[model samples]
Each structure stands twice: as structure tokens, then as C-alpha cells.
Target: MASIVAQVGADRSEAAWLVSTRREFKYDLAGELRIQLYTTKCSCRRAITWRREADIPDWINQGVKVEMETTTIESSEVKTAIARLREKAPFVYGLTNYVAANLSANVLLALGAGPAIGSAPGWAAAFPAGAGAVWINGAALMSSVTPDELDEAAATAHKAGTPWVLDPVAIGAGASEYDAILASLARRLDAVIAVSGEVDYLCDPAGRATAVPGGDAKMPQVTGTGCSLGALSAAFCAVVDPFTAAAAAHVAFATAGERAGERATGTASFAIAFVDELSLL
Candidate 1:
């Protein structure tokens, strides 16, 4: 009576199971799927394939045919995303920290996107509905707007069906407020970025996660780079799907950063070169 279930999304589908009892793989047959993992996050990665009837794994129902294929974000899609972003010049509304706001706006301008920073009363709910895309930085929310405004902005963005990216900044260790904000936004999740060192995991609501790896060694030395990246993500999201947009932004920024790094001697000069590189691209 064991069965396999697949929850399908627009671009991807996934079926996962708990690693049972250190000795077996358990399957349920009650016409309901239950997911419980011993570990919070699975580090071991595997390919899901059930090619032919004879090749099917022992755990799977042999009579059932599981169609599995990984659809990744291609370089061509990145190129298309860039082209569309420049063509559309998406109006990006950002709720970013004051210290980084100017630089973030300059970055968006160089990338051919109109950037607007919002902090005024009633701006959160109104601007997102009008923007091509929105980026909400938790650091900015903590300093500028009231606590409830972040929820309002996220809800408004979700209700408007606008593509928005929430940059959690720091996940833990002194960022409990940010984590609390994310916990509240969980139900209204659209696109979220997961960073593991230089590589970024762009994840969509449907569980489609793509790893886009690209960055310069000196890129972190500059100020406002992270904020700028979030705004760039918003601009790209306006033109393409969230996953592709995140990939394209990372790719684009890396390309610019690498070029700038090669030309500049110090972080101060590299910052200037980075903006110049973005515009030149």
C-alpha cells in the first residue's frame, strides 16, 4: 500500500521522504503524504531517476512511473534576463538601510533601473503596488518604519502579485528581530535568497532552488554591496522569474566586480570601478 507523491510546481516538482530508522526507507499508503525529517536540513544530495521499469529502485512502486527531470536556470536565461532588465528599466522600490541607500540607488541606476527608497508613512503599502518590483531589507525596516509596517508592505506586495525579494541581512546572532520578521513573512513568501559564502541559493516558493555561484574576492570589502545586490535582484525580478532574476543579478554583479577588481588597487577605487563596470555593461 506504499505510494510516492509529487507536489508539482510551475517550473519544478519534488518528492522527498524521511530517512527512516537508519535501516529502511518508509513509505505511506493512507492517501496522505507526511513529511518529517530527523535532521532540519539535508546535506546529502542525490539524483532522482526512475528511467525504465526494470531500472526502478526497490523503494518505489514498480508499477508507478515517476517522471523526473531537473530544470536549471541556463546562461541563456541569464542573458535574456539582462536584456529584458535593460529593456524594461524596471522601477525598483527598496526599503533599505540609510547608510547604504545612496550607494544602492547608484548601483540600480548603473544597472539601468529606477530605484526609489521608501520610508514615509503609508509608503510601504502604496509603493510596492506601483513598483515593477520591490526589495525589503530588514536592517532598513528596523531603523526606519514601525514594526507593523514591514508586515503591511509584505502583505501588500503579495496581494498585488508583485515580485519582491526580502534580504534578511544576517540570519542569526543579533538578528532575532530580522528572524522574527521572516517568520511572519513565511506565509507570504515569494522569493528568498539563501547565501552560503560566495555561492547563493535562489529559492522560489514552489521549492525550486538553484545555486548561482559567482563573486569577487574583494567584493565584500566595499560598503553597500549587499544592499545594492538586493535592489539589483528586484530590478531583475521585474523582468524575469524570481529564480532567474536572482541568478542573473548574481551573474551580472560578479562579472562587473571581477572586471573592476582586476583594474583597481584598493577597495575605495574598486567601488568606483564597480559602478563604472555596471554602467559599461
Candidate 2:
């Protein structure tokens, strides 16, 4: 499914619109015009031309109530947010796994943010002192940091009023205990929980959620995608609210992954292309 929305009047003509090629239309509004085209294949290049105003259904103008309120961030809004993030150049501190540390740092830097990877006994507690945001990757800490130390670090970040992002890598894949620990930490701080998979899900402390879909299938074959997302989320948090930050990171990475996949032949090349695409953003 794909959708295009446009206002019927000249007064609102200049207002921006959102184009989504997803399976569902979720929103919280009334009297909005939605033109949906159903296609068996999911392709961004598929075009649906609108000829005239009479082509629109009469019920679309009559108005309807939607129980679910889903907001798709406009491309313009994401562009503005990306520019703001580049201008702010906030410092993002990460506690990522060894496998993803390098890529995570590079991704943060590519997005025009300062990256600091620290996992010393007390580094997490001290790093966030002057950092714009903190990122905690449990996959990396499984061997490096103790549970108590990780808790202390999260507590320190919470007390310092710094926004943090938690990436529960492999949340439902035989990591129930670890998942609970991260979930508990998420509730204690102003944090964004980024759960990466075929469909990335981001949720704020208040339980509001955003879903980002559309990425290369090779994403799972590559290492550190989740970790890079966590770092990018922190980078975005430096300039925007946690929810917006998470959503932006998701869209940016997913979009970049798709572009990178088109140019690369294998995992190694895809990884390189992914970073290049991120920098171009």
C-alpha cells in the first residue's frame, strides 16, 4: 500500500505532505484526504498519478475518525532535524560491544557528532558529565562491565539529566533476564528504547511508539547495525527530543541501508557504502 495526502484548498496548498508506501494508514485526525494505492510489490519508484479533484472519493471529504494515532514524520521535518543535529555537533558517549564499537563511532562521526567509546570501570559514570547524550549497548557489556556497574552508569546519566538510548540487542532471543534489566533501566531515565530487527521499533519512556520499516535484507548479515543505530540515536538526542531522535535515527539508517545495498556486492562493501551514505546525509 501507498498513500498521498493533499489539502483541497489554496490556503493550505503550501503545507507539506507525507508519502508512505506501507501496508497500513494510521493517524489521529478528521476530514483529511488520503489516496491509497494497493500494490503487490513494495517499490518506492511506483508512481500513482492524480488527474483531477473529481477522482477523489466523496467520503474522503466527509471526514472519518481513526482510533489509532500514527504520525509519519515528513521528509522536510527529518531534513530540518538532520541539519540541526549537524549544527549542534553534540558529543555522544557510547558503551558498545567490541564488534560494533568502530562502526558505531564512525556512524556518529559521519552524522557530524562527536563519538566517545568508553567502558572502563567508572568511565560510563564520568563520560556523561559533559556529553549531550549516552548510549548503552548491552550486547557489548555482556563480558566487559558488571551488572551493578552498568546500573550505576545508567543511574548517573539519569541523575545528570542527560538523555540516554538503550539498544536491547536480541531482546527476545534467549536474553529475557537481560531484556528485563534494560527495560527497568529505560523506565528510570528519560530514554529511548531502540529495538532493531526486520522492523525497528522505538518507544519513549511514556510508552508512545514509532515503527520504521524498509531496509536491505543484508542488514542482518552485517555486524553492528544495531549498535550503530544506538549511537545514531544518541547523536540525534543531542539535538531533538528522545522520540524524534529515535525516529530520525531509524529512518536515516534504514534509508541509508537501502541505498548502500544498491551499490555493494557483499557484506564488507555494504558496510563501507553504508558509512559513506551516512556521511553524505
Candidate 3:
């Protein structure tokens, strides 16, 4: 599935298949299924709609009130936000002490979007409560966040009604603990706006994600990591709703990966250049 998304994120029709497939699995038999697509002036340049009924297409065409709320942010506003982030410095707090997360956060700032990278449950609650958006990168397990901690963070983000982006980094990596934490968070948080990952260890009933073929991008396994996707998430959340935020973020990264792969460069340069390129997209 990750391979499919990585390959198809740039191709609208193919990407739609992944969205619809995931929606069917995620929603189960609970609702009617309908799929809609939108055009956005962003890195990916496309949008997707998934409904659980046969009339969804008609509803979308009719501008049904329920489905009309999803919006695509103007490129200018995105540029404005990116410009704001460029001025502020990003601070980091998480289990994974690796500089990549911090670097990614800064890149997000450089491109646009204020970032708060705290894993302490208290800070997590406070940040998302007031923040316009939030990104939870489970890349670093950091002594295994308790169920209570994950719940508190998810709850705080949910209550604030802010966009929540979940990055289950390296779930397929050696850390079973990280995967466990992600599972708990997934079960506890019913309203995850969007999620991105390298492996398919976990996913929503909708199963919406844009993944890549492992080890093909030639980065140190740290290049173009969660930070890029998280930044893209921030981009959408800053302008659009969560679902759109998630979809756009996923597509942006996937498209970037496709672009990067086309060049066959090292991950470090690819990751850095990718952020700059994606922001403009």
C-alpha cells in the first residue's frame, strides 16, 4: 500500500483508488460510500472525497451543505504562513533525541507553520489546546508513553478542535514499543485527521496513507523523515480542514518522494531540498 501511494500520489486517478480503498476498509459497513476529488493549488495539486453512499457524487455536485465545507487553501495564504514560520525558531521535545525531528520542525518553520515539539503530556495538552494545529510524531518512543499520556495528548488536540497529524515513524522498524504506543493511540483517538508512516504496521479503517518502497530513496533512513510530512500537514491544517489537511500532506510528501527518486540524490540533500520544493508546491 505504501508503495502504491508513493508511486501514485502524483497521479490523481491512482491516488483516488488508495483513498477509496482505505475509506471502504476504515468505514466498514457503517455508512454509504461515495468518493469525490478536488483540485488544490498545493504541492500535490489534487484533493479527494470519500462518502459512504451512492448519492455522494450528486451531493457533491449539488453542493450539499455537509460536503461543501472542505476547502483548499489559496497558495498565497500558504506562502504567508510559511513566511511567518521562517522568522520563528522551533523548539523540540521528544523521546527521539535525534536531530532529524528538530531539523524537520525547523524546516516546517522555514517553510511556514509554528511548531511545538513537546512529548511531556502536560505540554502536549497545553500546546494543542491553543495551537492552530498539532503533529504527533511517534518516531521516538521515549520510555514508552503510558496509555494515559497518549490519551491526554489525543484528548487535548481533539478538544481544541485543532488538526492532529500523527506520524507513526518506524513502526516497521525494530521498536515494537513504538508500534504498541501507536496502536493504543489509534484505538483511543477516534478523530485522527491524518496519519503518515513508512511501514504498514498500523492504519485506520480508512487506511489512508502515502508510503514509499523501503530503502529506495537513499537517505540515511533519517532523511525526508516525518518532519517533511508533518510540515505538509501543518500547511494543510493552517488553511484547510483536518481530512483535507491529512490528504494533502500525504500527497505532498509522496509527490516529493516521487520527485526525489527521479533525481537519485542522497537523502540529506533530498530531504532539505524536498521541504523547500514542497513548500512552494
Quote the lDDT for 101 in model 2: 86
Candidate 2 all-Cα RMSD = 17.5
lDDT of 2 by residue, 64-173 (tens): 21122232335665787789999999988777678888888999888899998867766867987678877766555555655455455555666676666544343232
For candidate 3, lDDT tens digit of each residue in 1-281? 11011111111111111211011111111232221211122333222223322322232232111111221233343344434434432222222224446655655554555555546647755765666555544333343454355445545655555544443332121222323322332332222223233422223224332222221243335443554455445545545534444545554455555565566567676666655555555
Which 10 residues in a row give candidate 1 its minimum summed lDDT? 1-10
Off by over 4 Å in 3: 1-99, 119-121, 143-148, 170-216, 261-264
Candidate 1, residues 1-281, lDDT tens digits: the string is 10111111111101111101111111222323222112114454333233323443343332222122222334788778877878998888887678778878988999789998868888887997888877766557446565466556655766676666655443221121222222222212222423323444343334444554555677766766766776787788688755566567767776787788899999899889999988877
- Runs of candidate 1 exceeding 4 Å displacement: 1-74, 172-196, 201-213
Candidate 3, residue 46: the lDDT equals 24
Taking all chains together, the TM-score of candidate 2 against the true structure is 0.64
RMSD of each: 14.5, 17.5, 13.7
The TM-scores, one per candidate, come to: 0.64, 0.64, 0.47
TM-score of 1: 0.64
Worst 10 residues of 3 by lDDT: 1-10
